[model samples]
Target: MSYTIPFPRTALLAALGVACLAAGGARADAVPAAQRPVGEVTMSVGPVTRTTAQGLPEMVRRGTPILPGDRLDTADGGHLHIRFIDGALVSIRPGSRMLVEDYKYDPQRVSASLVRFKLEYGVARAISGAAAEGARERFRLNTPLVAIGVRGTDFVVRAGELTTRAAVNQGAIVMAPFGADCTAQALGPCGSSSAKLLSADMGQLQVEFRPQLAQPEIKPLQGAVFATNSTPENGSTVVAARSVAAAPAPAAPALGRTDSERLATAALADGAVTAAISGQAAAPVPPPAVTPPPVVITPPPEPPPVVAVPEPTIPLPPPVLAWGRWAGVAAGDGDIALPRAEAADGRSVTVGNAQYNLYRASDGQTELARGLGSYQFALDKSAAQYSLAGSVSPATVEQGRLLLDFGNARFATDLRVANALTGAVGISGAGAIRGDGIFFDRSVAGQAIAGAAALDGKSAGYFFEKAVGAGTLSGITLWSRP
Candidate 1:
């Protein structure tokens, strides 16, 4: 005689889910060696698939490895949640296709990390991780018409061929159209008068970009606007006929276990995997208690005398260009999008870096007057990069001082690049100042540092690119007279 045991419907479905995930892991060996795993699918529902870098397509389930250059596609009602190696999270909505353009993360040198994603079509939500926080300047998400840059952000994007929509869940983003001023080749955010700056403080407002326009328009985010469609082909439309999947059922505790723990037990019979999805670590078990012996207290040490040192004060000569970093903005976001240069008190009417209207401000009218003092580097407002063959990490800049002699019509600057990988690399350059306030490195192997002073004489800035072995070290600085 043979006996058959009955299984619950929910348990049966969970078992199948577990088996599908296991199969996905087993196929990992087929991926090429050069294409390493950048993330993993922690949760997947319905018809989800991934197209590999080599153009291989397969069904994706929970536990599937997400490789660089992989394209993820979801059918109607399909959903996917991924956790990247650097702790970033991405949620792909139904009827969506997202491509992981590039992802490079090094735990030891997170500043060198680069993360890029392209939302081919549909909607996706992204949460910044260590890679983004460590090197916000290197993170980018591209759409058909616009490129989005972030400074430690959590955001959502809906992409279409003609239009792109972006909303910030946390932090802020700089959205710019791909044109002569902003290009795909550049990393980090681009700033232009037409660029749109969106932050969570703006409430439920979303930035909408169109291929035909240079500036992005703002719109309210209605609940129905982002809903998934019952019909897969109509998913991208604003109106929704029906929901593809039902909302998850409320949890009912079986024991004293949490909802996640209960689901982990039912799904894979393991809680470790659930921890990754929830972004929570398991609580450590306390050690066994033991009786303590008598303790003896020690006497406190004597305190040392304190002395206050006065800070040095320097007098300002005259106003030329008032050099100051944009208040309340991170250095990674680059320059603020100023509509026009502001002229004040006979100073240079505009202030910006190489990427801005500053280059155009040299219209033969503004002149650099002879000044005695030097402009000091604002370390807090400056940023540098140390680029090796396979990496570009942040470098500490110190001893930054630019000496200017308008009487001699010359300028010189020296700063040290303290890089963990290459140690400290000294950089020193000098060049003749031109009548138009423009200057170029005259030192041999010139152009080590090329920059200009504001015609108003209030501010100055330069761009540096120096070769170090097989790699190059580069950075930009904003200076003010001291």
Candidate 2:
């Protein structure tokens, strides 16, 4: 029933040629809950959901069941594994979310029997471990409206209500409707023979598909920006998505006075919502810095009435230590990998993996940093240089996790725009704000800023815990712009 083909030397080399990545890795995110596989509960929050032995991860909680949205996090080296009630495994990275509506496992045959996950925002890698190709126990994922038919292949989906981006890392993932008869839904040019589903150049909301398009960049029919170069067999076409997932924030938030919070808010601001589900909120703002008052000493009452005790001077909020949110970070990549970054001003710097000589953004001619560890410089209102050093602090929840010295922004760069950093407790990344936008470019030898990832209407929060199962997990390298 299966067939295989051998390739000639020329053909084989040609095939490998196209496989090379021009630059970037993948612009994606992952769901902490639904991304994990079941057999081994890789990650967990609480009682919300679990990756069943043969089930995909599910949305355990939303903001209070219906109020606010809950956020999950991961990094590059991290992934959220989910199990399909039928025995499927899904892996998600740092920035991802899923809304679960219905799922029933028929362990007898190992299938979704019936399964669905609404990828509201972020990225997800789904692998069908058990569901048979043509068997009725099909595994499927839905955006607001359109549906995706996930085969045994490994597919990572980045979705928004109007614009869903589906890229196949290993196998092909077909998009169809929920419960629609596979054969009955005779798509005109269904397979690779039909051509590319769309071109890579298609705008966010205006992607057109053709048979010639490459396999890896095949974005299914969920995003609002889809175009039909050719007609389908169905006389009347179904518009597909009920609504878009979310719109992308502009460029990175500018580094300035407004971005002092902690968490970085993204997603939610990009697409529209379809069904009701719980997910993470925007990154939260950092708690305002509380500087302890200077110690004051009172002199003992002297016998002489003329002798007066001197009062201690309370130093004003050290302009340098007056902490508040700086302007937003440039729209950064969910998979940012920057070398040493020079702060906005020529004199300041922020630390990174690589080393570099940076010219300050605030002043075009000044080279504020060079001979130092990976560091970025910033300028607030001063003639002083502050460095945002990157390092793992033993006393941090995000410890070992990459942390940015936000102070570098104000003192170094002249922000064109900015967003707020949200957080809770001592440190949290939740909430929404505005920003100039930022992103990473993998094309360069040392990955650098390719563009920006604006975070206008998202949020962040910190609920660090392992309530699900495995309490020991290496957080993902997802946001390690490090």
Candidate 3:
């Protein structure tokens, strides 16, 4: 016999409550409620994954909250687009790994904002937003080879363990290699002597930084660097002439019997015909030989009257110039002969060294298709220059359009530029195109206008400057065919 001691129901309930609390505490530790989200995934495709600061792995999707210290890894065909709280945009390409090292922003206190990002490998395009624009000095993008600092810019960068390549679509950027003078702890762009500046006005130039090189080198724009604009392995923005419509389903193929079946059917038909012929009664002999009908001859109908049809005249396409960048190459140089040169003037423009010579395209052909068309400003590749509190800042191009008469080689523009901190200005200009597809004039409403049509004649870029108040406003404009 055993004596039983009564247990309170309250004690049993308390024991179960303790176990549930322990389990819930563990989950809370994985994702802290105190940690604030820094950004959100606006677009995601393919196999993109994110690792949280506490080492929790999550599949990325649209609307995924991006917390600071979280690392993103994109698989072979993955792409991720993120929009930060401050309105900055960053797109990560396939096989890429990126981390938001640090971010801090306050709309009320704009000057104190700080933004930084690290690209471990692969490619990405960064478009500066409010935080970067408000505090340019405090913003930075770190890569393996260099640290990129923006000046109100939109740029693409490819980073690897040994090298880094950058191209600016709008505004400018300064890149400096990691060295004794430039440390990783620094914010914004490094101000070392090795720092090199690249601006949109440089005419399609890219900057490459390598560990072996003393300074970043300027290079011709590489088509591969601009592959983001093309349809990528994952879903990114695709450039197309027209929108594609959904296609209808194809009709089913007509049904038919196989060769073997047809042969068998033919054999049976032949057997039936032979049996019928053999079973038929014999026919009577013909009554007599019938008289033949009279033969008749008729001439062929007269041929249709010949008519000469003149062929439609077709116009030949205009000559297209090939563009390039020459460094340390001489004039009429065999290694780098001037493209489409009629004859070298023997006089070359020298920039730095006496060995280098640049052949002006003014002497080359620039005839293009004749038509009156309009070009809209590409804000992604356009920027305005202004000063904010005596420091150089990027101004906004509110609206701009160019009306060009290709037949007459004349152009007119209506552009409006403004700065939040400064005043806005409306600019109008008219110019005549040159034989080389260049347009230039010293004074357009007291401003200078100079630009040239692109090699394909579908785009144009120019630099503008004007005196405003006590300072000056200078900027670059990139226009595309509408």
Candidate 4:
């Protein structure tokens, strides 16, 4: 039987959850309750030492609850100045106070990350890697007013008794919508319980010094103001900008120089005053420029809390991919780079000295037609289809375990290949072909697997007519999950 934790996905628990503590409820539930990983996790604080339960590097000693003083850092050199660790680097500036429930990372599984932190009153910066491929690694911030879930790339959080604000800097994220739990059926994306109040409850949450949006962690430009402004007009609030004008020469030095030049040989003959003038003739070398001291930011005694609100209903549009790129070694064999397409009213796209006709057919199949001396070649497919066909014979489908075939050519399909959404390819009276994973051609001789599958083809069992020729696969990069 599957062990499931009775955790609430709603928002009512966002505030005042500290009173509802349970053994392993928050921490373990963050990792699906049942999945416990065996690995080394550390939390480091300050410059000198590392410790546990006390001091800087807190060990998170088994049963002990992580309190206000502890900070965490991981083996991958990730710095966690505050909060939990789900690849979310929470650097709390000064007086921020928060509670950490759990953090887990599993490199083996693409989605084995789960992190949760509850901000009571503080300023926190979160540089995140959330929902990033593996299991259910999520970064959550619990404020006095609401809960903030990051279904996004990166953002910053600041919350307090009077106010809570979360600003997204990169990628996308969402605060589970309010009023979500109003109905027993479903509240859609945001429920009434999911609505979070921002710019509220934050009494003295100053934006100064606290980075609302992130800044690159490099040595900031010295002798210049470290300013940050929202609009181009607000400019940066000068963290520090020092302009030291070159030192001026003493007035006596200039007069003394003119006198010394006049004294010269005559002074030796004439006598004393000339020697005095000569002795005073030198201009003191300007003291070597003092390297300005490193600026230290003394955080406020009290920092604000951070919370997130539901994103707007109309989500942003996706970017368009213009397949105008040409891929081929400078002096080697090459074919059209993939998502192999077919055409309708197409144009000639040149690669090397030759040009291939690219067509976006009305039926959505992409086609590539190129002439090579006596033989004319073409490959056609809708970028979504798992099947493809060449101008040659015997059409091929995805090989399921890993690979795509076209006679003798085999291309790695594990990550490099993307299943097409529409269209088909036909080379007529060819032989048998077999495969899986969105396979639309024939059947595979072996196993078949897909995150999701869709296949349609006919032959003896899969597809068999002529004697299948060669089998080959090529050109694709594997995307890893850690």
Q: Per-model C-alpha lDDT, please? A: 0.68, 0.31, 0.66, 0.31
Predicted model with the maximum lDDT = 1
Which portions of model 3 miss their true places by more than 4 Å? 1-34, 226-482
lDDT of 2 by residue, 130-227 (tens): 44343433555655423566544555555543234554434445553222222322321223211233322332221221111111233233321211
Query: Runs in model 2 with CA error above 4 Å?
Result: 1-40, 44-79, 110-112, 132-137, 176-482
Task: Show where candidate 1 strays beyond 4 Å.
Answer: 1-33, 230-482
TM-score of 1: 0.43
Tens-digit per-residue lDDT, 1-482, candidate 1: 11111222233334323222232475756855446687778788999999998999999987888888899999998988887878787888898999998898878999999999988898888878899999988999988778899988878887876567777767999998776567776778887545788998888777877532325766576444444542232123345578689889999968686778657434432455677678888555466699898898989987887878789889875433333332334335443222233423333323232222223244345566555344444433456767787676777677687876566778888888877777898888887876656665624341246667766555676666667776767666667665
Candidate 4 lDDT over residue span 165-260, tens digit each: 454444433443112232212211233322332221232221211111111111122211111112121122334668999998767733345665
Error of 4 at 266 (Å): 97
What digit string (tens of lDDT, one per residue) describes model 3 on residues 198-295? 99889778887754234577867766554543333212234557878989889899989888866754433444566668996445445578899999
Candidate 2 TM-score, true structure as reference: 0.26
lDDT-superior candidate, 3 or 4: 3
**CA RMSD of all predictions:** 31.7, 33.4, 22.8, 30.4
Candidate 2, after superposition: displacement of residue 296 in Å? 99
TM-score of each: 0.43, 0.26, 0.43, 0.26
Best of the two (1, 2) by TM-score = 1
Best of the two (1, 4) by lDDT? 1
